[model samples]
Target: MSTLQIGVLFGVVTFIALFSGMPIAFAVGGVALTFMLIYMPAETVGLVAETLYSELDNFVLLTIPLFVLMGAAIGKSRAGGDLYASLNRWMGRIPGGLGVANVMACSVFAAMCGSSPATCSAIGSSGIPEMRKRGYSPALAAGIIAAGGTLGILIPPSLTLILYGVVTEQSIGKLFMAGVGPGLLLTALFAVWVVIRFRQEKARVLAGDESGATREILREEGFTWREKFETLPRLAPFIGVIVIIMVALYGGWATPSEVAGIGAFFSLLMVIVIYKCWRWPDLKAILGGTVRESTMVMMIIATSFLYTYVMSYLHITQEVAQWLVALPLGKWGFFVAANILLVVLGFFLPPVAIILMVTPIILPALKAHGIDLVWFGVIMTILMEMGLIHPPVGLNLFVINSIAPDIKLRDIIWGTMPFIGLMVFAIFLLAVFPEIAMWLPQNVK
Candidate 1:
């Protein structure tokens, strides 16, 4: 009967609806309406319409579709192959070179695409086959792609960070800037893990272990300087896109929305011009996919506003915050518990849904503890990044498996475990230093 009890009951119902095969937008919106009609005054029904309209009216949200469109165009084009070709020419001679190149390519592609599955699909389609050809195990190849792909949500221009910014009322640009350090940190960790795996496998191969026996130890010949230079042109379009977006954003030349539009246009233009692989069918498919994906994100955003509305009216955030703050757990103890809960949730939920659903409930507590929203955005994005590589619901694992069907899902999951550990290590670094994520955002003009 009390507001808090009703709010808690509504949350339970919403989750049940989600697990029972209802769409997230529908589940959240339907539960919210059901509860509002029962508990809120009839005169307050207008709040639902107002909340829906205002949420969709946001100018920043336009970036979501544009970024999705840009990613679709790039992913549909030859950029992935070009990226792998160029990087492989340089890195292929190193131990586990193709895997290293895969991580690098994913990081670069993440900057351009701003999506996990897109990065996984685009890179894995090319990288997995190449690594397999070089005698890399299918599991290691698929795992690298799956884990590397998660950078899409943590790198600059990330949709996850954008949504987090919108939900927490933080600056989107600052969140993007904050993501760069952590993104690169994860990339380094993954790359290092690849090298360590390479060494271990090499030692096993020398010991006559069957599993590692067929693995290639080195490239037959290093590329000539001329050969290396020849491959560099393939990456020009990708590099140009990254430079334009970064300079436009950090140099104060444009807003995030404006840059997203520019990036989308340039991505399409590159596919048609530089790649010269454009076709009417591909364009149609890209647009169709963009429409579907963007619509899903928009619907969630629109409905989440209603959920936020109900919570606000009921003062649920305040009550929860009071409870959390009253706990005997200190700041560190509270964060440890929160991180564990998020990691568990990461196994079951999509990143966008997690942000929309959990953020409102947790923001008040985080704010009460003086946790900086921008810093927490980076931390939360990393955890969500892990979710994309986590098994069962780790969407990127499925994406990679779909691209490289010969590799078993469990093998891919196994390969991802080490990277998952690296991600956790990155989180630990963020927790201890804080400034790793905060320094840039705070120092930026």
Candidate 2:
């Protein structure tokens, strides 16, 4: 059989494994191993071992555990709750203030945690109950947290960006930087939608949009100017960590790995000293959680790298890319089609698998079209975010589902529909004005 046929077979086998409920790491690595034994000499087994070592040996991977530690520390300390409370008190009276606060909290936590589910759980646990108590619709309240959590991928210190960089061999720092503009854009768009929805809901309640339904309300009391000022200090630890990491990463004071170390130490310090939140037992739990999460991500990455190597050995990826480039779809058509494919695939596959499996094939076509990879990474990340909110397989939807079990899956899907549209709009915005994602990493120091 031709090499291209082997590559197609590899994809078919891998997809079947994934669909059969096999773990992504095992499925990918297993398929690669099966292909290698059949098509290559036994001596080539060493190639898999070498690829695994080289993929994990890099300094950038160190950022994963440390940043995860920082997130775990903050999560254990309940800073995420305090951060939301403070923002809630301040924004509660505004239209859709609680929802707005949820998005803001997710963005801030996304900066710290770099994990979507963590952000969803940390913020949703607090935000959902509060919003529910305030008479917000279950669908609306759950949707905001579900969709907003996706910012975890687009914000700095994003695990998704880190993995994308590792898989594609792009600079991790620049990819992080590129994510900032698009992240902020999506956040603003979400906030706007929330406020607008809040107004509509408010008007409907006042006008009796739902017969006998209680009016959704903003808390008009319990928080004064003085109280708002007093709550500001609760946020200092989280804000300080952000400032330190941002300065270190973009100010050229440190590499991403070094910044991760600094962030983790300070996060631990905050949990113990400022918040006085954790005991020795809590600290041990945090460490264990960090190890578990980091190990899971690293395993997928290592095995996927091995899988990627096998594809290269068979020259499958290049052939796929060449086939894509040969299509008569032209540049814009190809871009649109790729986005559509990713959105559909995202409904079934998680972001990590999509990145590892799909990126190599599309890269050559992208290069042929003269697309800038840094810019494209940001675009692809947005699509991945869309996938996170897509139903049936969007990891974030399930995260929200687990946190707020009262919310029906259908309602959650309905709630996220508008946010998904905003994400698509975000992609279009970036495509037309590539500078939204490119300007920072290109010009920022």
lDDT of 2 by residue, 356-413 (tens): 7888779889889987888888888899999998878888888888989988999889
Give the distance in Å from residue 137's predicted Cα in candidate 2 to where it truly belongs: 0.5
Q: List the residue pairs that clash in candidate 1.
A: none
TM-scores of all predicted structures: 0.95, 0.96
* Candidate 1 Cα errors over 4 Å, as ranges: 212-221
Best by lDDT: 2
Candidate 2 local lDDT, residue 38: 90
**Candidate No. with top TM-score:** 2
Query: Would you give me the overall lDDT of model 1?
Result: 0.86
lDDT of all predictions, in order shown? Answer: 0.86, 0.87
